[model samples]
Target: MTQPRIVLYSALLCPFAHRARIALKASGAVYETVEIDLKNKPAWYAPNINPASKVPAISYGAPPDSDVTKPPAGTFLLPESALVVQFIASLYPQIDYKDPIIRAKASFAQLQWDNLVAGRWRKYQFEGSEQDLEPLLEGLKQFSDSVPEEILGDEYGVADIILGPFVTRLFIFANEDIGKWAPGSGPKLVSALSGPEYDKLRKLGAKLDKWPALQETIDNDILVKKFTEILKNH
Candidate 1:
């Protein structure tokens, strides 16, 4: 079977873009990547590729071009990380959900995490106070407990791909660097999240350690360094 031609527009440091990239890789589909500079987006990118001018946009089943409004016949343009990941998963049989019910459940779970848990983490990371740490810790514990033992039994699927990137960032960067970046509140926040009270969350962290695809996605040294630099400046 001929593989669909895919071009991924992405920035390495964006976790959302990273999620789409992971899905693409795990699908075992051959696709080209065009890294976009988020700081200085090209003039043609917004008009031609994605109106939102975001990384992790994809042009499917066709070569990349300057048509902004729509893709060529036999192809389509998809933006947004979660939607792009779902589209690729559906297109390729290799990484698709084994059961429709499970797919629905996982999709719903992913949405909840994205909207609620991830939002809380972001709030704690950027504008959290000492009083805010307890809620964030509680949220992390709830999130970890809510996740299925493997999410899809023995197979890696969409839900894992969707949440894996942000989970990695939270444990690695947020836990470690929050103190240095945010001062007094930082260390306390990290301790509360990673401390004994949240061992379930730590166990979830261990699961991510064993996920090879996630490791590959989050282990980029250059990406990590760049993200750390950004956080330090934040």
Candidate 2:
């Protein structure tokens, strides 16, 4: 099946948008990208593409010469990073979720990491409370343990596509000491991840960094600088 022509509304620094970028890149899809300025979004953005005015939105099936602010009738407008990734993956014939077993495994992988991420991110990454440190490490250990080898098997499928951005960001931010973490908490998190407990996740993160798609989308220096600036509530 032919995938629709996609105009991705994205911001380079956004992890959410990076998910879509990875999916699109890995799928070998031919899509145009419109980098959105998240700070001062264009006037046409919200009404034309995503009502939430967020990055990681897509304008699907619009013609090459189509007006962005007013796409022709039947143009499919989609928002949210995960959904966009899923939609793109669904179109590609190679990344199979058709088999019931694969389907179930994918669902479980996504759910497990999704729940874990939501529970731990704010406390550990952003707020970086001293008390929240151990809990976050425990959660990551659970995540690494649950990651089936088959989930991230030969092909980089939806599971990897969805989780790659966050995991990569987590590793980079932790190691670079970039975030609003309490004094010494960032280094502690970094040190803990360097230990034997996180060997699985650490290896997985390194593997992701090697992927051309992820490598292209993620610039380690840029991420460190960009996130550090953003985290400065100073």
Candidate 3:
């Protein structure tokens, strides 16, 4: 089958967009990226690209009478990072949910982690107070044990793609003593993950460090500095 022309609308600092970036790279899909300025989104983006005016929106497939310079009138535009990641995963057999039973299991597993684990971690990173450390610690501990060795056993799959960006950020924030990143939780989470209790999570961290696509994204010094500046201002 001929592959569709894919164009990704993305922002460098968005964690959600980072998910799409990782999936697109891992899938080995040929795609173009249109970097959007979240602060001042382009005039033509809304209603035409993504109604939500969000980054990580994708323009996919070619129209019946496709024009080389423009997406087809029938080009499919999809928004939301999770759905986009799932769509890309569904396209590539090597990294997708191949069987119905496994697909169902993976979906449920990812949903559980999203609700019970990733959501809490996000809260701790953004809105957590000093008083929130204990619960956050407990949550991280449980999450470490709960995350599968690789979201899909041996290969990086949808679950891993969805969680990879956030995990990379967590590892960065936890390890660095960024004075104001997260008052108590940041350092404490680092100490906890480094300790014997989170051996499994430490191993996962090691695996992430070695993941080529993720490492490439994480190693973008400019983007890292940009995000760090945002954190400093926060």
Best by TM-score: 2
Error of 1 at 51 (Å): 0.6
Q: Which ten residues in a row have the lowest lDDT in candidate 1?
A: 175-184
| lDDT by residue (tens digit), candidate 2, 1-234 | 565678888999898999998888888889888988898999989887888999899888998788766778789999999888878877775654557777676667667677776568666777777777777878787777766666554466676777788888887777677767766666677687787777767767877877888889777887787777888853
Angstrom error of the Cα, residue 29, model 1: value is 0.3
Question: CA lDDT, every prediction?
Answer: 0.72, 0.78, 0.72
Which residue pairs overlap in candidate 1's backbone? none
What's the CA error at residue 51 for candidate 3, in Å? 0.3
Local error of candidate 2 at residue 172 (angstroms):
0.4
RMSD from true fold, candidate 1: 3.3
Each candidate's clash count: 0, 0, 0
Q: Which pairs of residues have clashing backbones in candidate 2? A: none
lDDT of 1 by residue, 1-234 (tens): 676678888887889999888898888878888878899987878877788888889987785454434456666778999789878877766676777777776676666576667777777776665566667666776665556554635577887788878777776665456423345565555576666656555655666667777777665567557765766677
On residues 113-199, what C-alpha lDDT tens digit does candidate 3 reach at each position? 676667666666666666555666676676666655435245667766776777677777666643343556567778767876667
